[model samples]
Target chain A: MGRKLLLEHINVPGINTLEVYRKTGGYRAVEKAIKTMSTDEVVEEVKKSGLRGRGGAGFPTGMKWSFLAKPEGVARYLVCNADESEPGTFKDRYLMTNIPHALIEGMIVSSYALGANTSYIYVRGEMMPQIRILEKAIAEAKAAGFLGKNILGSGYDLELYVQPGGGAYICGEETALLESLEGKRGNPRIKPPFPAIAGLYGCPTVVNNVESIAAVVPIINDGGEEYAKIGIGRSTGTKLISASGNINKPGVYEIELGVSVEDFIYSEEYCGGIANGKRLKAVVAGGSSVPILPANLILNLVNGDKRLMSYESLSEGGFTTGTMLGSGGFVVLDEDQCIVRNTWNFSRFYHHESCGQCSPCREGTGWMEKVLHRLENGHGKMSDMDLLVDVSKKIEGNTICPLGDAAAWPVASAIRHFRDEFEWHVRNPTLAVKENFGLAHYADPLPELVS
Target chain B: MLKVEETQSVEFSTELVNKFAEIVSRYPEGKEKSALLPILHEVQAVNGWLSSVAMDKVAAYLNIAPIEVYEVASFYSMYFLRPQGKFVLEVCRTGPCCLVGAEKIIDYIGEKLGVKEGEVTADGLFSYRGVECLAACGFAPVLQIGPEYTFYENLTTNSVDQLISDLKDKASKS
Candidate 1:
């Protein structure tokens, strides 16, 4: 098995409880950080770990902490973006559900490093169960003297609270999360004064994903250099891959960052290959927002090098033939699935979740959804293909948030990779609705690798 | 969406008022506005949905304008604008789930309930809707019932049938 930092004790009975978690060396990082290291020392350790934000952006976590504006007398905040709403991404929910205290411990250590006494975990409201689990965990930690005022008698103080989002996907965005936390509508804010500079009640704030925060525990416990030694260069440390869709074992898997895409999908150690012995057709290696790649492209690079599940490797060829390791939401599709219907389904999700903050995303997502809906239902015109791409182009990078680009990428990428499937839907409209345009060239053998 | 016929004024119980106070305490002193989402959830738990009267009352309690509450309530998918059945069955309908038969599960729930999406059953026992990704695609074909938001995952049609019956039995008993 790959090294597990966050989920090492995940299967331990009663790991969700403070006693079991503590017994298994859960809060050692908190104790080590608070009792021994300076705040800067903790930050320096994270910086040295080379941990990137696991929420999808892949921005360096240590650098994000370094960006926090530390103004005198101004309360800094660390808001854990527990709103794991991206389609196909459920690793945060899994991590938070199974090992609640790991996140709480990470929260305390991270809050200290950012010099924030007050922090809030902005969980999506649908995860009321997780919110309750975290709340119970936080209460237990506070009772154990790991949280609240003067923790561990180290003269450091911190207060952590769990805030529920109002079930909007856009709240997963950092600034939008801040807005939702304030109990306002979930709308993306214009950048340049990113959340690090001014956030959460206008205080200097840092918003990190749930997995990113939880990863801090091991970084502090093992020392950053030791933690960084596990994964491939730059994509240091293990990542939690939420493998879903047509995979045989569809669940969360903690993988060392450099694992080949083929091993992750087909090996018994990971996804255990496609379900029902079906051939793999396509894979959304990341969440729905990232480009969707056919089987041939996903398993190998354009140059026929084996694709690895790291930030640099997955995104090797850019949007053309490459996808992202976004949120590690690896969704696999077998031979039977229809790309057209799935594209339409994703477009509908984006349109429904646009937040209506920007017209390009707001209007553009609706157009994509409507157009894709027609295509999926076998009512598509030939020009509808170009129209879809045209609309996607208009929306990409034209909105205040990435939601526009997110909505556009899947539609554009599906057409880019599977235009014939879409054309088949158009030509054989009746047949398309009755049956899927099966695997086709997507499962073809890759060209011989160049030495 | 709050029709004149459905606007019923709500009274905050002392117990609930105390709960609101606790939620408000989690934020900074002046930023009691941060408590709005949690407070609305608490209020919605009491009543099945947020009426204009209830929302305005929430606005009054938070010291924010009533429009703030309305805007937030309408913006979010969770808060019901109309009265729903005792159990709101939210099934995941996004791409990953659909690949693994989430759409079938949603259709099953709808057909079994005899109520289309957003429509409450006559018995006032259940309502079902297709929600966007619940972030549980790994356990696709999943559904959850709210108040506690208890999840039911990897649902087959038979399992869904068992759930509806179980929920029906539960409602009759309680």
Candidate 2:
């Protein structure tokens, strides 16, 4: 069994209640941090633990905390990004639904660490159930004296509120979330003034992912060094992978960071392999935004090293033969699935979700979607593939936020890794719409490495 | 924009007004504009959708301009600007769900309801549309109904039929 820090007691009945969660050692971090350690000490402990943001970017958590600008008499805020809208990514929703108090406890400890008296968890509006759950849990915690003025007799004042997003995926971005929290349209802000420097009502703020904040409880419980000792290299501690799409066990699994891709898929511990005895065709290791990898490339690196689930290991070859461990939304495609259809599906999602703050992302995503739609519907020309590549390149980095790059990567990567299937569509036209090209060479074994 | 065709005015109930007041209290004093989204949700939940009058009243309640509310209400996929069926079936249509048959489920719902996507039924009881990921891909081919956003997952055509009938039964009882 792997070490389950955040979800150790997830399956216990009544775990969502404060009483059962308390029995399972919840809120111990709040007591320890508020009553014993100073704010800087809590931050230092997280820094030593080497925790990275689990919300796709993989940026170091402690470093993000340190970036908060603290001017005297200026209030600091910590906002939890609970907007888990990326397709194939559902870990935050699962964690929030099953273990609501875990997040509340982390909020208390993290708010103390940042010396902020106010915090909010910006959840997506579609998760009305989860927002209600967190609200109930927060009220229970407040009644227990875990929140509000002078918590646990420690003279630390904190108020945590659950903010609902208006169903915009762009709000998952830190600045866009802050904008939404301020009752504005979800538009990405230009950087030189990142959210850490000035955010939410123009205060010095720190926006952390829900998982990153929840991981703080365990880090503060056992010392940071003990927490850091679990996983390999910089990818310390366990990560929750939301396995979906053609997998037998399509659910959230927390694994120690170094598990190999093959074992994670085939082993009964994780995904339990592709569903219904089907052969794996391809995998999107991260969420939809990351590059999709062919079966051979996903199973083994270009150098023939077995790919592991750690941030460094999964991204070893850097886009050519490797993909990100983004948000840990591991989606698997069986041989029966069509890459062209899936690509078109993802393009449509991006096009619909483009916030339209930047012209390139707004226009480019629509163009890609239309072109891919035609390609899938048997109306594409041979030059359509290159046109897609060209348009995607134009949108890659020309926007106010990474949503542009996100809109670009899947289209580019699909063409890079699966051009032949696209060409087959252009040539076969009507036949392509009637049937898929099937697995083709995607599942073939990688050529042996020459010494 | 506000559907000018539907010019029906709405009056906020005292209880809902109090609820709006509570939502506004969650933000800092000068930042009552922050209460806009939550207030709009509450308004939409009470009435089936936001009319020009309802949004104007929400703006007055929050002391912000009606355009502010209009821009936000329009920007979000939620917050129906026009009236909808009492039960809106939002099925997931993103990549992962499609991999596991979301599209087929959407088509089945449309066929069974005798209404296309975004169109209300003749009885005005149900409307269905393909929404983006609901963050429940593991339980792919999922659909949810609004007002509470209750989820129904791992759907087949039979499950969808059962759900529509159950919802019809529910509406009849209510």
Candidate 3:
């Protein structure tokens, strides 16, 4: 009920300081876990809470921690995946910037659960400011005996470090992140070894996202089961959705999981409705990686649809009538927005971001990008629309990582829901709108520096 | 092919050493490698791009393999393996920026500098590159120099010439 349940005392200016955070009960979770609760107890508490990973994967946090192979004298690690590279997803950035201590505290408790004496927060390099905040927070935690030797006199020593990524979207994948952590190329590795079994210098490691760790602090502070009771079956607790794009007020909203799709969009409480008094055309319920839902299906609750925002509900029909709440990156598009153009934009990002390690993803992403480019820029044929769909199919599951899926899903989904628009663009061979409203906005060019 | 530290002929000062140590202390025990990025960053702060000598000092201080450091250095677009010009011009070439003619601006700079996208000029005044989204969407056409971001709201031939002249002026003053 209190804001501190997630972002408590965060807004009190200067509260980021250790002295202020201490006054607001910041490291209380770490202290209580180390001093009182056993490592298994902490894990059990988290498991009972029904807390799931907020890092798009939706894996159970306790189950992930429980998976670490505890070999004798072998080093185990807890890696906080702060890479936050998902587009329209900046919740982790907001959390790390405003509440660094929350993550730091959570990491300490989670590390203790997994017998990890050392933890690393792998932040994206582009987040230069957040990196500074984490470094400062770690220093404060170390100074307060919340980290380093015998934390809180419990003899359960742990250390934390921050590693910035080298600007590759693929590195956001756990194994690739581990590879990057090892100072190697940031390319995804085959699963089954899955970070938990072999990761971070080939040691047993658990890589949780920033929001996932932040959620852990609350689970530890409140009994895990108590936290789990807040949301619906299987989808427990609150999720932080970074809502942007054609929304009246685009910011991060902490919604109780399983809230209805309609309520999330139209409710005065959530996004405050669409921007510019425009009609909602469609929704990319998750991050850009998920399929788009048509406005009719997304808003239709009468025909046994029950468009709720949960793992089970959104994915009930498997893209037939519903989508996912992935990473809670809800990007709402208004009627004025062009689905074809937006999909093309995402296609280019995936093509540029593909690590070139997998043949299908490497080539398919480029082909899709080119097709989308031709479609968006008015050089496309009707066959190009089908070609985009066909290319997405080729790349979906043929890659080492889900990045291929992340690239293919949006284009595939947009085409599925808005094929007419893609066809319209090809048939017209001109910009969709006579006014070129968004294009005029794009007329001005960035400055040229001889450098 | 040459290592970063091996290329730096100058010896680092005690002040720089202390700065590097402070960055190293940010991480906890047996996690010294976590400080690799920041350490390289600090080294670059001292000597423009990561020279072989600076990288060597970083690897030695953190007890990491030099190739480990090199892998990270080369992988990131921001980290330069070779020395750049006085000013590093990073233009955003992603969707929002690209939609607004980022490519034209990059081409303009390439032509003016008499070099390609990644090359520095003979005079060492400028080095230009096209980067991903800089998160300045309000200013669709955005370029960053050091920490300063300048948005081209209404770019034209005149504005392009002015930007180049401005860079020359700023380079001379520095």
Candidate 4:
């Protein structure tokens, strides 16, 4: 039943239309939430339901809604963080492309909860085609009177706009995104005023990710308590995971939050097992930003008791063995993959995407990237291994945003778990060279084409 | 915040306006701001780069705040805030592309055009900048001419020279 909660109405004929969505119990949440429940009651329902932010951080959704500066004379905004730029994550794209109305409907209901008048969907600029699709859906929603002044005889006035970010990865951070939305650079600002106090035109604003808002529709429609009953413990409700890398069937999977990591990988029910029948070597449980775990650590039960995927349980082992459930981008690594090489790939992405605002991140990312690049290219000294660790340590926790930490985590974790791989590469560079890096598509015609 | 200059006038030509109107008709009513990206895109397409005047006119047409229009235009890497040359070459200088001498291509172009990375040529014929993920990973090193994302696969010094020559030839004719 939880296999497709977010993507439930996806396959229905013409489900893209407001009429069809309404027929299938769409906007029922708004009807129930607006006409019946008070805004405080609605927020309480969400809080009691234990619904967490589905956009990686797993922050309590209702609690976040509670943070808004009450309906003051000043206007508040609901910003949907649709800038899904995490490596190995593409579920938000699917939501935007196939079932945009779900997101739009959710936006209306959620905006009502926080007493917001204007909402913006800050989508990544790279997703040009998906943005076009969402634009059409939003237009349809407005035409049906689901948006704008007076909605379904309710006097709630709301306006939705789609803003395309300049494709900076740092914009995924809420403060940075708000800055970018304000027609400036996408560099993140330190939080104190928080978006809830002063955001977007210096008014209280609520920024929730794409999946986080979409989940709110169902929570309100089916009673948040009932939604909470599905998943175990504090890891309530379902999670939309974007699984990729070495897996046989890599794509988006919506599952009850506490499903075991092993079940997700080995069970035919999820992911269809690893591709090429290769043995799993490691898994980056969350996005590349999280730590990477070796296969043995993931298979073993926590404290040798339970094998679980809940936020608390998964992170129990910390970066030493378990990875963060951040963003649910499960990128698995096959045995053929080299940990050093893969870690370098992640470091390289962060280095390129760094906003260059914070000194530590700006200087440290470059140093780490240069060290990793030299090591990966088979030109490494033993001291370079220590240097990589040293650079990552300096970069993490020293920046204005989580991006510096996100960039540093993979490098630090990879070295921690697979120092031998780096040592091997340093000891015998030629031996470490594989005939093929297993790139999907190689420029040389002799290599297999991806498309 | 930008006031449209009297000389530039911040108004669209008939051709760009027609394209903009056509795009607007594609969306539902009251969501005209959705066309903001495409409108700015069309302005950039016709006017080379988005001048402050052009952005203001676009803001007026979309009925969004001038700041909103400017935000979209500036946020995207593709949109040029300042003026660019007739041929703007954006070299992909991140990861896979950088692994195999995207820097060399930039160097070659700089030497050929006699301008630094962010500088437009004195003749206003060429400008260069570094970018990320042109989505041509297999190509290793790639560059785009204006908005035309051209991938130069398996690049060498000679191959880049050929591409420059080809671009120059095409620009001269067009």
Q: Write the per-residue lDDT of candidate 1 for residues B115-147, one digit (tens) a residue.
A: 788888888778889999999999988888888
- The number of the candidate with the highest DockQ is 1
Name the regions of candidate 2 deviating beyond 4 angstroms.
Answer: A448-451, B1-5
DockQ order, best first, reads 1, 2, 3, 4
Give per-model TM-scores: 0.98, 0.98, 0.83, 0.78
Error of 4 at B172 (Å): 18
lDDT of 1 at A283: 94
Q: Give the TM-score of candidate 3.
A: 0.83
Candidate 2 reference-contact recovery: 0.88
What C-alpha lDDT do the candidate models reach, one value each? 0.92, 0.92, 0.75, 0.75
Candidate 1 regions with alpha-carbon error over 4 angstroms:
A447-451, B1-5
- Docking quality of model 3: it rates as acceptable
Better of 2 and 3 by TM-score: 2
lDDT tens readout by residue for model 1, A167-242: 9999999999999998899998999788888898888999999999999999999999998898998999999999
**What does candidate 2's lDDT look like per residue over A10-84, in tens digits?**
889999999999999988998899889999999999999999999999999999999999999988999999999
DockQ of each: 0.91, 0.90, 0.26, 0.13
Give the runs in model 3 whose Cα sits over 4 Å from its true position: A1-4, A301-306, A432-451, B1-36, B47-71, B81-130, B133-174
TM-score of candidate 4 chain A against the true chain A: 0.94
lDDT of 3 by residue, B101-146 (tens): 5668878878877877777777877788887755433234556664
DockQ: the better of candidates 3 and 4: 3
Clash-forming residue pairs, model 1: none
